[model samples]
Target: MSNSSIYTIQPIEFRLDLKDPFLFTAHHIDHFPAGNTQLGPTVPSTPEKPYQMYYGDVVPGFPEHPHTGFETITLVESGFVDHFDSLGNSGRYAQGDVQWLSTGNGVEHCEMFPLVHQDKENPFELFQIWFNSSPEEKKQDADYKMMWREQIPHVLQTDSNGHQADIRVVSGSFLNTDALSRPPHSWAAAKENRVNIYMIRLEPHAELTIPATTATSTRFAYFYNGPLLYIDGQEIPFKHLVELKPDTEIHLKNSDQVASIMWLEGEPIGAPVAMRGPFVLNSTEELNVAFARYRQTHFGPWPWPTPAPVFPREQERFASYQKGVDVEYPERM
Candidate 1:
């Protein structure tokens, strides 16, 4: 309840305020109705429900968009995401899967959330994090990788009281578990960067101790879902972000209800950052050049039929890579 491990605590809105090496994080939790003929929400979003259709008229998702100078790590917690990109790659990934897209140089992609189930409610939840790239790496070739749910490591930690904490390692290492390899040009690809993204779910009344990370790394824990959490004996309310001293060990205790937290840690890139819409660059001049180039090239042109494309209802989880062989997962249990 009393410790110097916590630097600050703030409420989280639509996006979590992050530090260097991390540009932005958007948390989407939409309660969509049954699918229409087009597989979109049957009813329009209202002020009360506020089910955002974000650039998608027929679906609740983002249409084809361009990005540069950064990488997008999309973690799907529930529901599914249909992905289409200008590189002639497409995929339909579902719960627990992670998609890492490096828009180096430039790339265009669309992420559509389809209401596949017509008989029941389609509750969608995901976190899309923008990881910043260094100036030199920004000019590298674009790359993409998919870490399926089965490929990702899930570490279970049991406290002395027998309570457990389930941790999903998306990037970087935790305890003895190392995450899958990231893109070659990604800032996280360098071992010295110390970038780590972990999704932790604590059972009711669970207590877990997080070991100290590198002294130079910037770390924060976003408590997105839960009733109550205690950090170092300090009570932390739900939907709050806590900045932690990376060099100090941190203790977490959850209340009676299940609690979930997203922990992000990375060494700062220590570069001038200039962002405009989806483009991120080192300076305003570079940002302008990026826009001009996009207008000229349109990021290799949209290859998909529609800006927001969705797969057939019966199509299972799969990924069609541009330069690699296609992959298909086993049918959902």
Candidate 2:
């Protein structure tokens, strides 16, 4: 591994509004490109829109669009993603259900709120992670996979200090409920694979420190529930995702209140990135190809065998939002 330049949790300045009206009328303050304007236009683009665990919607039919070259893992923590695809698989992927869709070789999928959830009011939470696959893996298959909370290993552990965490293995080890400090003990192998993830709960004004390691890997953390901080000498503003350099230990404390954090870190996938409306690729040319394919015809050798229900409201709302909207693409790549 190579040493990475140090970085700080530049405060999350960008807020996006949900353009798709049929979807939840919400704002993703961190990275959603269309997060509400009320949060303002200053939301800077960092590593990108991180994985957001969205709950049930005020409406349905979100982010109504197509995708490919990525696998969206929607693990339903509470409600469901009543989804449909060009493959003709249409049904509700409900609470405790996990929806893993590989948009390889191109595929168009839509997520709509279930009729059952309409006004019924259900709490739904899901982690939508954008996992990158090698170009070869991207063309291997287009498919949908689902698993229940029971099927996946959900492990729990508590320390004598009254700190407990529930672990869910999602790609990487997913641990939640409590944050762990520098291990009293250490290991070589575990440290080598250092891409560990955790959801930590912090007590008011509680402080902790993350020790530096030898391997030149970067560490990123997101504070969601509280104003927990990855300190910067002075009180630097906090963000959902904070990036740090290797050998850079972190000092953290609740911002005078209880806090929660989602911490993720891994070696960077140093690839040229190109992204446009649900598609992320290495180059704009690839994106253009994807857009051409998406516009001409739904991607994949097989399109939906039958007609999927049209979310008219979602369509109209997305259209309206698309109007007077300028997608700010990354300038560097």
Candidate 3:
């Protein structure tokens, strides 16, 4: 079937295996020089926060983990994720709730679900966005906020074929309305990297279209539930982001079933982005500071690292226990 995206890929004509294409699995620990970081007889405190996150081919459950520098945007499509951080805040958002966690300076938090309850016939799906907080906000008090399904404003977008689109702005916009913009900061008005996040629903064989965003932006498109035959002039490798030329309108379709796609675009913050294990920093010095703090149990909210879990200290003992799944050790001679 010929489908059209915002803009067509010109039918460049590439062979694709929409049913099951090859994918490179991701990592809980994204280290430099690629591959896993060296581990000691016992993992350092930072790595043992007692959490398990689902990576490609990994069992899903989380004792939990820590993060800093960026905001985590979570949108639930089916199941739910209960989050508890050092701030003593706990909430389980499911089926149509969105949660945003901004860990600016630093924070020790964990994300996990006690069980996966099935949704009326659909499964669970979500998009976790990591946005860089302005360098200053990073060190401020940690914050947790959840917008319920009803709280999310709904607007109908229609394509030429009576396909009605339902959209929710987790943060950013729909025309003149800024329903989910950030909580006010210089970055909000500075106008550097414009990051817009949206939750969209498409009907069977339906088409959702959008105007061209820009040339220098990066778009992370994922189909958490259902399948998408994203049409760019040509047929793209199905189920994968068919990168289009800049200023190209986007046309997407739900062919296999009622598909759902999360679209997030932003200007590259262009900061020194460095991450290792649980810390993300701009310099080796900052990384060292994070390491020492975990080693000394000194890092906490408001000064350098933001406080994430109010009860992290209680889990200190289990923090040393690691099931140690398939750690992708670096391939070296």
The stretch of ten residues in a row with the least summed lDDT in candidate 2 is 16-25
Tens-place lDDT per residue, model 3, 183-230, is: 443233233555656777777767776556667765545444464455
Q: Write the per-residue lDDT of candidate 2 for residues 1-333, one digit (tens) a residue.
A: 122333544444332111100011111322223322221112333464432323323333452357876556564544445566665544455544555666776876666543332223233344554544445545555666554444555445454455443444433344232222211111101334454444455665656555564354546555555554535443434444555554666666556666655555544444565657677667888888878978787664333332334332222111111112322111211
Q: Return the number of clashes found in candidate 1.
A: 3
For candidate 3, the 10 contiguous residues with the lowest summed lDDT are 16-25
Stretches of candidate 3 exceeding 4 Å from the true structure: 1-60, 116-123, 183-192, 224-228, 236-238, 253-256, 301-333
List candidate 2 segments past 4 Å from native: 1-6, 13-59, 75-77, 94-98, 115-120, 123-127, 154-160, 174-218, 227-239, 246-259, 300-333
Candidate 2 lands at a TM-score of 0.58
TM-score of 1: 0.96
Q: What is candidate 1's lDDT per residue for 73-116, written digit by digit as tens?
A: 99999998999888888899989999999999999999999889
Off by over 4 Å in 1: 46-48, 323-325, 330-333
Error of 2 at 18 (Å): 19
Model 1 has an lDDT value of 0.89
